[model samples]
Target: MSTPQPPTHQQAAPAPNWQAAPGTSYVSPIPITRTHLGHALASEWTKIKSVRSTMWTLGVFLLLVVGVGLLVAVNTTTEDYTEVPYTIPAFFGLILGQICLITLGVLVVSSEYGTGMIRTTFTASPQRYRVLTAKLIIFFVVAFAVSAFAIGLVGLFTSSLHDGESGTPWGRSVLMGALYVSLLGVLALAVGSMLRHSAGAITTMLGVVLVPAILPAFLMLSDSMRTIGEKMMEYNAPNALARIFELDTDSGTGGSQLALLAGVTAAAIAGAYALLEKRDV
Candidate 1:
């Protein structure tokens, strides 16, 4: 029969400290606002733009594409072609441009791995697929910007030079060219990711992209070798891309051929992503 007395404020005891030591720093929690993917995209964009290779590759593609078109157009004379009034600047430069484009793609991913930055990239963006998509988005945008410049210049200059025959449709040609270049870069990105070594990726891509063209030339020296060379050139990426650019040409193949080539490259890219997931960071 008695009411409990109110406890005094001074009676409460202090809780024991659980931290390792007085001088030790506490681990910080991940921020709620952290946008790892956004950070990765921005960093990737900066890295892509900052590299000397990117600048050189873009500059060279611009010159080879626009400059060559201008040169060919200026050099065209009345005697050049009577049957075809307008000339599509010989696409020989595309051959070289592909190499540059592929290099740009390869460097996008391989350079990171080469410099031991892949670990950091993976750590920052653990969602591997998101990282791949981010790189693709950034690379494609850059490719489009540069491709527009090159293809637009080609169309503009070619229109000026030719007097008689109908010229290529600027809109279609430009769009196709941009898509082709962007896809080539994407293909290179896949190769780079799988190989993770610049030399190996570059060499392999060169073989996949260029050997087809060269084989036909080198093998032509011998009659028996001609068939071998011709077969190799049949499914080449450059040839398939050329089909996309000039729809009128026989293209030695059809839309399905292009789809097949793209499909193979896409499969390769998917395989690279799978490897990325399985392998150590």
Candidate 2:
């Protein structure tokens, strides 16, 4: 009974999720570092390379390009190229291969939304704009590289096989062909961001890239619309790419088409950025 026992009290431990500061959430296990666009770029590169969709789409694209290109090369006569130029054969393959790039581009953004992985991506990197920018850069670079490779292969094979087929405009064909594909990819990414649904985005991009090719054919005697339709065909991706190859048109003025595509892509991206900022993940 001697000494009076003091009342004992248990104190509660600080919870992990307790807000330490205004607007500050719980700390993540990832090391705190100054984050930048480079980090987001690396993340985007990893995602694009690791996905099977990228592999399958790009693989089929290469297969179509190489296979059709080689066949065209073997069949082409020196006379056939004298008037048409050597790199024209690549147009046949690239016309189809472009669809693959467009599909892959849509998948890059839309697939994430479809699978709900975009939530995780946004969570890890809170800067939404950076993530979208990273994706656009990574996708455009990859698309350009792959398309250039295919176009380069076709151009080289056509040149070598024909022997002394000078004045082929190799520079314009390879460079512009790659640019055309990359531009289309960027557009598709923008559309994907806008739509956020895989099928809808894919369908919309398909119309953008493909419908123009056929629209001119179907437009009959609408006077004002006929002129617009002809312009659509003139500026359509396939025709523009063909112009790069110096086929179907002697001007080979792909520069104009490239400029137009660049303008459209820039506008679409601006719209996408606006939408991204105003919307929730």
Candidate 3:
């Protein structure tokens, strides 16, 4: 038999098959999009309001600002410009409230990291820019609102204390203060997002913002130190923030410096988002 012609060899393979398991069905993943910003904003707003710190900080911020204004108005030896010269009280109280805003900003980004919920956040909003943008929008809105309350309370209280004195230009002051507070919160959020370490971000912000202002005052050399202080004043945190006041305190030292700081801060926030987008959360 022709050696039984060598049989042509062919591979045997498992049959193609498909079946659904009992009580099981295919589920598709939800598509993420920019429109998801609304959901993100709602979620963030819920998270912010649910926190105890938010309540405490708002209360304390209002109390300190209003209390200090009352003190300054009541004790003023001369009602120089009426309005009880609440600048000292308002300014210092604002500085204190800023620390709280920093903490709030940190929580905006870090709380998710702390709880391992950032993964979910990223999942729900895979387009990282949307998530960050949503966060910033929410922060700006919330910060502006809270700052208004604090500033308003101070103005109201100060106005009450000054019976014979004219009202301060608080309407403008409050508006400007609100803007400053919003910017400060944004700065904190950007730094916190970039660093991802609560302690490190907070410490760095405080050190950079507060320590430099103090250093200028301590130097022994008067003229040179004054020059250094003046130059450094151009970089000081308060000046950058003081822009909201709108009162022309000094040209080079206050608004100009803060305007520069705001510009730099906006750039930093953008850079931070870029890094956050490129890195693993």
Winner by TM-score: 2
Give the candidate number with the greatest lDDT. 2
For model 2, the run of ten residues with the poorest summed lDDT: 15-24
Q: Scored by CA lDDT, what does every candidate get?
A: 0.72, 0.86, 0.70
The lDDT, on a scale of 0 to 1, for candidate 1 is: 0.72
Q: Candidate 3 — which residues are off by over 4 angstroms?
A: 1-35, 82-88, 164-168, 218-226, 239-254
Clash pairs of candidate 1?
85-165
What is the Cα-based lDDT of residue 183 in candidate 3?
78
Model 1 ranges off by over 4 Å: 1-30, 34-36, 77-87, 163-168, 216-231, 245-248, 252-254
For residues 22-97, write the lDDT of model 1, one tens digit per residue.
Answer: 3557533432344667776897898888889899988898778777767777877644544222324535456577
Model 2 over residues 1-281: C-alpha lDDT tens digits?
69988999989886655333335685664455678999999999999999999999999999998789989889977777765556677789988998898899899999999889999999989999999999999999999999989888887888888765655557677888889988898899999999999889889988998888888887736776888888898899988987878776665568888899999999999999999989887
- Superior candidate under lDDT, 1 versus 3: 1
Q: Give stretches of model 2 more than 4 Å off.
A: 1-31, 83-85
- For candidate 3, write residues 206-280 as lDDT tens digits: 886788678777653587578777666656667654544533455532455547667867987888888887889
Which of candidates 1 and 2 is the stronger one according to lDDT? 2
lDDT of 2 at 10: 88
Question: Relative to the unseen true structure, what is the Cα RMSD of model 2?
Answer: 4.2
Against the true structure, candidate 3 reaches a TM-score of: 0.77
